[model samples]
Structure formats: structure tokens, C-alpha cells
Target: MDIKTAAAMHRLRLISLPEAVSFLLLLVCSVLKRTTDFDAVPVMGMVHGVLFVLYVLFWADAWNRTRWSPGRAAGYFVLSVLPTGGFFAERMLRRESEASVIAARARREGVVNA
Candidate 1:
């Protein structure tokens, strides 16, 4: 992949784990607020919200620059919402980046024009 696309994907990949953690923590905070006096929801909410926004921005950049198919794009979007989905997204993105590196190398070596 080109630098722009690579950077976009890298940003998304880096944020994935932290975003997931924040989301999970936010959920736990919600439960705690309801069942107990614990009230960290606002702080965790803000953190998760910022992370979620960054994730969406990075996702859009990657989608636009990489020209992922609709299904592929939807899969990535879906992964962002689930509790542990970021981990899966990270793995998927890693595989895609590895494949791109291999493809680029092959092209440099005069492989198929495709």
C-alpha cells in the first residue's frame, strides 16, 4: 500500500485496542453506576467518544485511500462496534498490510501487472 493508505491503516490499527478497552470500561462503568455508587461514566464516556471518533475518521481515510469493497468496509465498521471486535480488526488489518507488502514486493520484481 502507499504511504497514505498505510498510515491510515496504521492509525486505525493502533487505536483499535485502546478504543475497545475504553468501550468495555465504559460499559462496566454503566453497570457500576446502576448497581453501585461508582460514577466514572462521564470520564470514560468522553474517552471512549474521542477514541470512537478517531476510529471513524481513520476508518474513512483507509476506506477511501485503499478502495476497499463495500462488504469489506462494512465488516470493518461492524468490528468497531463490538466489544472485542477491535482485536479482530487489528488481526485483519495486519493480514491485509502483510499481503499488500508482499504484493508490492512482487510487483517490484516484475510479477504480474495485476
Candidate 2:
């Protein structure tokens, strides 16, 4: 992959994991507020909201640069809302980025005929 593609994917991967964590924590906090009368919901809500926005921005960047298929793009977009889906998105993207790096290295070193 080119530097721009690589950078975008890297940003997505970096933001996705934390965004997922925050989403999960938000869920927990909301549940606690409802069930246990805890007041941590607002703080966690704000954190998750910020993370979600960042995730969406990064995802859009990656989608544009990568030229992902409609299905792939939808998958990434849908992942933001599902609990634990961020982790899945991160894992999927990690694999993709790693493969891209490997391919770039191989191409640079002329390991495979172009």
C-alpha cells in the first residue's frame, strides 16, 4: 500500500480499539446508572461519543483511500454501533494492514514478479 493508505489504515486501527473500549465502558456505565443508581454515565458517555466520532472520521478516511467495496465499507460503518464490534473491526483491519505492509515489502525487494 502507499503511504497515504497505510497511514489511514494505521489511524483506523489505533482509534478503533480505544473506541471499542469506550463503547463497552459506556454500555456498562449506562447499565449501572439504570440498575445501581451510579452517576458515571455522563463522563463515560462523553468519552464514548468522542471516540465514536473519531472512529467514524478515521473509517471514512480509510474507506475513501482504500476504495473498499460497498460491503466492506458498510461492515466498517456498522461495526461502530454494535457492542464489541469495534474489537472485531480492529482485528480485521490489523490483519489487512499487516498484509499490506508485507506485500509492500515484497514488492520493494522484488520478491514477486510484477
Q: TM-score for each prediction?
A: 0.93, 0.92
Per-residue CA lDDT of candidate 2, range 32-77, in tens?
8889978798899899999999999999999999999999999999
- For residues 4-114, what per-residue lDDT tens digits would candidate 1 score against the true structure? 889999998999889989999999999999999999999999999999999999999999999999999999999999999988999999999989999999988989964
Instruction: Let me know the TM-score candidate 2 reaches against the reference structure.
Output: 0.92
- Model 2, residue 96: distance off in Å is 0.3
Give lDDT for model 2. Answer: 0.91
Colliding pairs, model 2: none
Backbone clashes, each candidate: 0, 0
- Give all candidates' CA lDDT scores: 0.93, 0.91
Best by lDDT: 1
Clashing pairs in 1: none
Question: Which ranges in model 1 have alpha carbons more than 4 Å from their true place?
Answer: 112-114
Model 1 weakest lDDT span, ten residues long: 105-114
Prediction RMSDs, each to the true structure: 1.7, 1.6
